[model samples]
Target: MSQSKPEERLALELSCAICLQLYRDPVALPCGHNYCLGCIQNAASAEDPKSPKRCPECREEYGSLETLPKNFKLSSIVDGFLVATTGGGLRGGPTVPCDQCLDNPLAAVKFCTRCEMSLCPSHLKKHEERHRSLHVLVELPAERDGKRCPVHLKVTEYLCVQERLFLCSDCLMEGSHQHHEVQTFEVAKEEMKRVLEELGKSVSDKLQITEALVKSASEGPTDKAEDKLVARANILQNVQYVFSRFSTEITVSIAV
Candidate 1:
């Protein structure tokens, strides 16, 4: 099979599984899995809090999701990737118009999933007032139709583990998926994002360490054959570590 290009691989590394978009405010769990802070928290909230929390990918059990660490390295990498891909043109890209606007459509600031509409500053203010206590606003392109179950034509919010398919609320209520292991999409995405984030971090760490080691070896004394041999061996070891770490990350990412 053909391998993914460098940019494509990096894009995959930077994306969050929950929203299937670039990560925002990524956080790392104890299991080393990375996820968007809000995504993970929302997934955790759905579970019974009394029980131990499990890592989304590995299913490794851990207590408390109260103090997850922010993955600064991965976040920086994502920012840099965005800059490179956008060619410093992050601002003036094509934009989706406000769905609420009729005559002259304005650039939408946020999308209301509940209302299935994009809102501009003016309309958004009104929406907030009307549904002050209950609203679900998200980034643009929620892909509502894409998220619907093909069989039932309802939103596929649930994942049937046994069948490995996304199911709508109706599927569960109708007993078609009775006794099958299931989880919310939020839960499944959280787990997958966690693993991908951890792998991205691991690869970054290895690259940094390898670069430092190579620099050190280049500057080291090599007057004698013995010293030269040692430096070469050290550089070789660092290169091997970096390659192995990257290989592992690619394998895990592809599997995911």
Candidate 2:
């Protein structure tokens, strides 16, 4: 029994309640329960509207339907762990065990719309039925190679400048040649480099313009200060001239 407990703990630690594989989008319910988004939604929808929506295991009723918020920090940690374990690939579902109990691995997980995590199928179903349109299930496409040419056995070797498509060398010469300008593999690569260089220069020019504008703005205050100083000096000079003229007139009066 002691050994069983440890094994159960390990299993729960690696498994996610919703996806039954691992947690991708983990969410915390108002009842302090954690589940994948899809799993909870499904669980919430399983019962008839006339009945209360409750947790499957605890049977605790949540009277209102509200979409769960995503736990971003937990998701990041889980994603990092999975990536490290799988060599940067999400090959299998989550490896973390459930937090509720150490026994009984999670099973049949689904995606939750509100929570943005995978949920056990039962939980997800319940969420769907109760929340109605609150939760949405998304279908993601599998990763595919976009560079391969389906018609030709060979890899894409040429790009049609006019048609703007990657084509095999044979296809470029035979079928696509009539209307399109064909560029060699090497030439296309060079053109890309040239385009990047031009874009870099354009960005640099814009940055220079921005710098000039900032410099001009900074000079505005200095220009105002210089103008004020010049006006003060002119006023002082006029006062000195008036004093000198008054002294000359007084000296003449005293001599007479």
Candidate 3:
């Protein structure tokens, strides 16, 4: 649970705001929001090129697609993240075998949370037949063994911020988290989305400043070593600010 939680947050960070998938050739907009290159390009193509190009996430306008920077560092990190999460070769995590299988266990297609068992299609149909109204069957591997409150054994729909854990409805009424600050998962996710938007704006501002400085330097004669050093220092400072803010926001987001 400890490891999976962080991986989930990392997955969120790597996902494109448009496609909602791991980035394929990620690029950064002038607004500092990241998206898959093809996704953003297709969006730009769908609109009039002469008109101001606005980011899908932040709606910040930029001039042209030609000026958008490919996020090579983020792309590299995506590669590593995929490898680490998927165990280097496989595109997905290991399949959960059907708990009902007696021999030669088949891969599970769904998980019955109420029964607390993974099921193949045959077993799933039987499960649906007998307990259609009662059972909560979720797609296998996606929800990852189903998110249930350990104490109440109910589907966890709320997050207890004080305890840094998920809570079911009963938890809010009678569990240890009864008096703590809590929010629905949907609300928490929305809050994180706003945090991400603010982080994007902060990055955009810092990068714009750095870009302006670089453009100014490029326009003039930069033959002196001291001038070059100063330019490099300013650029580094801006970059540091961007990443520091990003880290802080992401940490807060994961905690939520």
Which candidate number has the best TM-score? 3
Angstrom error at residue 190, model 1 = 52
Considering lDDT, which of the candidate structures 2 and 3 is the better prediction for this target? 3
Clashes (candidate 3): 0
| TM-score of model 3 vs. true structure | 0.41
Candidate closest to the true structure, highest lDDT: 3
Pairs clashing within candidate 3: none
lDDT measured at residue 121 in model 2 versus the true structure, 0 to 100 = 31
Candidate 2 whole-model C-alpha lDDT, 0 to 1: 0.54
lDDT of 1 by residue, 179-219 (tens): 89888977877876787787778777877876787677678
How well is each residue in 1-256 modelled by candidate 3, as lDDT tens digits? 1223465567667777775556767888877898888889889899876788898878899767778888999988976775664443123444555567553343455677788887754455556667765888776656554565656555678988777798877888985777788988999899889988888898888889888887777676756768877887878887887798799878878777
Span of 10 residues, lowest total lDDT, candidate 1: 86-95
CA lDDT, every prediction?
0.68, 0.54, 0.72
In lDDT terms, how accurate is model 1?
Answer: 0.68
* Evaluation by lDDT, superior candidate among 1 and 3: 3
- lDDT at 23, model 3: 70
> What TM-score do all the candidates reach, one by one?
0.35, 0.32, 0.41
Query: Which ranges in model 2 have alpha carbons more than 4 Å from their true place?
Result: 1-11, 63-65, 91-256
Quick one: ranking by TM-score, best first? 3, 1, 2
Give the residue spans of candidate 3 off by over 4 A: 1-145, 218-224, 251-255
